[model samples]
Target chain A: MADTQRPLSPHLQVYRWQVQMVSSILHRATGIALAVGSLLVVCGLLHLAAGEESFNYFKSLIGSPVGLVLLVGWSWALFYHLCNGIRHLVQDVGLGYGIPQFVRSSWLSVAGSIVLTVLVWAYVLTPGGAA
Target chain B: MSAKDVVVKDRRNPLKVARGLGSSQSGVGHWWTQRLTAVALVLLGVWFVVTVLCLLHADYATARATVAKPWNALLLIAFVLTMFWHAVLGLQVVIEDYVHVRWKEVVLLVAIKFLAVLGALASVLAVLRIALTP
Candidate 1:
């Protein structure tokens, strides 16, 4: 057969945005984000091991504005991935295949993550909390 | 015709030919490990978040003392190792699915593995240093 260029099947642009799609995409997006966040973990460990001076520097860096932003983003990402990942693991075992259930769970993942993030930040900002 | 005298040609479409023949035999292992590590992470990740939160405003010596504790040090090591393992597996799938260029895909996959391994080792070493030293 002759080689030919063929238009690919309808892509993301062709689909109407929906919760299910958003949840699916966010799972991957947050997964990627958390993967990058893993580097921060290594840095913290190394600095802690290095001694008081290095550890103090690492602490201040993460306490800065930019670091707080990244921390907040990663905390949300972690929660979202955690919630959605559990949903996925459940689905893998043959439950929640119904469309309505799937949609509900998708929304649950999003809502749950937001709530967790807010609660965490609230605690962090509270006096005598993580701050 | 005698078997030696006749050749059977595979005339199926390329897609059909490739169907069910694409398994490199390691895919299942990769998938299973990813899930297993994920399960581990769920527990470890929560523990880690709480631990860090507890140390939020702790001074350097206090933070060092907490990490130097036996159980915290052990779980911290486990958490970092599993985290990098899970991250590598997840990144590998993302690269495979999205990076269409053959060479770029291979380079990324290799690069991610090397980085994850180095990161994991560094974390383990650091954890050991914290745990072992006074």
Candidate 2:
């Protein structure tokens, strides 16, 4: 198999980076991240059911620096995936097929996700807001 | 035409040849279900975020009580199930597309399903415990 070199179709390295590409790639990446993050949900529920001590411990763990960092990352990932996923759903319905519309929607997904993420963090950081 | 001239060359039926070669007729089901779950998650995800935010700084007892509420428990269970279902479907597509090695791909696909199923089950059980207990 090593002896015969076959010409492979162009992939990531071959194409110039564009918003469409970035949006498509990030959708998958964030999806995978969120999939892994689902485990955190399971852990939270389990601890809550266990007892007060366990619940507090779980809260503290998530409140720690590293956990906070991960939480932020997952928050952004969630927003990004949600926005881009909606874009995909719209495309599936046969809208936004033109090149200009396509490019515009791609940027919309990126910008929308960022704005949403910022809004979420702003709320979390404000007084009386949850982490 | 003569009967002999019209004899089929392939012994196996057409369905046999097509069985493993193309979609098992489940591809559309998978794609449709993924979209359906995505739609469900949009509502549930927003509800979950708002609910958690409302519980901000709540003590353990308050948090537990909130979760034990009827609507909260029902929605949480729905969210957990839908999220896992959507995650598994998305991950399956990713694994199938990227993992080239047959054995590795099969192992990963199966592993993710197992993990998602267990995670969903555990979350549901935990919610039930919270909802059922005083």
lDDT of 1 by residue, B71-123 (tens): 99999999999999999999998888777678889999999999999999999
Query: Model 1, A56-125: lDDT tens per residue?
Result: 8998999999999999999999999999999998998899999999999999999999999999999999
Q: Which clashing pairs does model 2 show? A: none
Docking tier of model 1: it is: medium
Candidate 1 displacement at residue A94 in angstroms: 1.2
How large is the interface RMSD of candidate 1?
3.6
Model 2 alpha-carbon drift over 4 Å, by segment: A1-10, A129-131, B1-16
lDDT of 2: 0.92
Q: What is candidate 2's lDDT per residue for A5-111, written digit by digit as tens?
A: 55332378779999999999999999999999999999999999999999999999999999999999999999999888889999999999999999999999999
CAPRI quality band, candidate 2: medium
- The TM-score measured for candidate 1 stands at 0.90
lDDT of each: 0.91, 0.92
Superposition error at A44 for model 1 (Å): 0.5
